[model samples]
Target: MAQVYLSLGSNIDRERHIRAGLDALAREFGNLSVSRVFESEAVGFDGDNFYNLVVGLHTDLPVGQLAARLREIEDANGRVRGGAKFSARTLDIDVLTYDDLVGEFDGVKLPRGEIVKNAFVLQPLAELAPQHRHPLTGKTFAKMWDDYDKDRQKLWPVHFPWP
Candidate 1:
């Protein structure tokens, strides 16, 4: 089995979608290593704030299959596709890293570029897997978070209960 990290977020019906997403992930992947949920303003487009968090799991499924499964989970949770690149979402889950593999696999980029670009993705990731290195940058998530510009974006930890 390979260790995988995923970033999950939602702006529409944030709490319900976030919890539903976690439920689906846990049901499919067993126990998960979860990070504190954070609330952040939408990036790239004007929209409502989002609830975001990171989750770690181990799976034997290949990258392509795993990505497809995640999409199904999102679809079941009301995710809409073919919208603008940046828009409101009911559930958005991204594959961040797949056992240190880099580049695109099955059309999904490992160690997602958003890790370095968005505080919402990096903050929870650093909290969950501080020691894990970025597959391409070789920098630990903790260090990346420390180096990140706090003012570039604003996000704060929120009271989120997940089972």
Candidate 2:
């Protein structure tokens, strides 16, 4: 089984949308490890602040199949296409990485350059995979996450019992 990490976010009905999305992902994947939800301002979007977190999933699904599943989970949560860049979303799921198997599709690369760029992703990811090393840069998730800049944005830990 490939250990996959995904970033999940929702600005519309923030918590509810996220909860629903989590439920959907759980139903589909079975084994899900969710990160503490972090509330942060919309980075590029201009609608509402979002509740974001990273989820670690263990599955045997291929990268393409996993991506399709992630997109479907987001779509089921009210995400609309063709909107402005970084628009507030009901559910946004991005495949951060698939167990170091890096490849490109639709012009985007797995572990996509954003893995090291966004704290919303790295923080929770570090929590999930402290010892897990990156495929390209070879840095452990915890190290990269701890080293990222968290200047203006704040990450509030979600303390609920995990799903």
Candidate 3:
């Protein structure tokens, strides 16, 4: 099985969608390493705040197939596609890393760029897998988060109790 990390976020009906997303992930992946959910202002567009977190799991599926399955889960939870790139979302899920694989496999980029660019992604990811090094940068997630400018984006941990 390959170790995979995923980023999940939602703005519309935030709590409900996030809970549903986690439920689907657990059902499909058997077990999940979840991070504490953070609420942050929407980046790139004007909208409601989003609840974001990272999840780690073991999967036997290939990269393309895993991405497809995630998309299905989002759709099942009312994810609207073909909208503006950063519009409000019912549920958003993206593959963050597939093991230590680098480059675009099956059109999904490993070590997703957002990991370093956004506090919502990096903070939770670091909390989940602090020692895991970036496939390209070779820097630990904790280190990256430490060096990131916390002021660039605002995010805070919320009271999220999950299974």
Candidate 4:
């Protein structure tokens, strides 16, 4: 099974959306390691605070199929398509990485550049895969967490339970 990492977030009814997304993922992958919940300001565009978390899962599904499943989960949680990429949503799930494979995803790219530059992504990624190295940069999540500092000014712990 490929070890895949997923980042989950929402600003619209953030807690509920995040919880639903986590349940969907648990059913899809059977098992997963989820990171602590964090509250971060909207990445782009203006919106309410986003409750975000990252998950590490082991599954045999191909990257494309996995990405599709993530999108489905978001849709199930009331997400709409065709908005400004960062517009407010009920759910947003992004595939950050799939094992060591890295390439331009026909549908959704793995390890999207934003994952590396964003602390919300990095912090949970470090929690789940501290030792896994980035495909292009060859730096472990923990190491990168130490080296990089994105706009963390707005990121705060929600202390919301992880599933």
Candidates in order: C-alpha RMSD to true structure: 0.6, 1.7, 0.6, 1.4
Q: Write the per-residue lDDT of candidate 1 for residues 20-120, one digit (tens) a residue.
A: 99999999999999999999999999999999999999999999999999999999988999999999999999999999998889999777899999999
The candidates, ranked best first by lDDT, are 3, 1, 4, 2
lDDT of 3 by residue, 16-112 (tens): 9999999999999999999999999999999999999999999999999999999999999998899789899999999999999988899988879
- What TM-score do all the candidates reach, one by one? 0.98, 0.91, 0.99, 0.94
lDDT of 1: 0.95
TM-score between model 1 and native: 0.98
The model with the greater lDDT, 1 or 4, is 1
State each candidate's clash count.
Answer: 1, 0, 0, 1
Lowest summed-lDDT stretch of 10 residues in model 4? 148-157
Evaluate all candidate structures by whole-model CA lDDT and list the values in order: 0.95, 0.81, 0.95, 0.83
Question: What is the model-wide C-alpha lDDT for candidate 2?
Answer: 0.81
Tens-digit lDDT string for candidate 2 (134-154): 888898988887777878466
Better of 2 and 4 by TM-score: 4
Best by lDDT: 3
Count of backbone collisions within predicted model 3: 0
Give me the runs in candidate 1 sitting further than 4 Å from their true place: none
**Backbone clash tally (model 1):** 1
Error of 3 at 89 (Å): 0.5
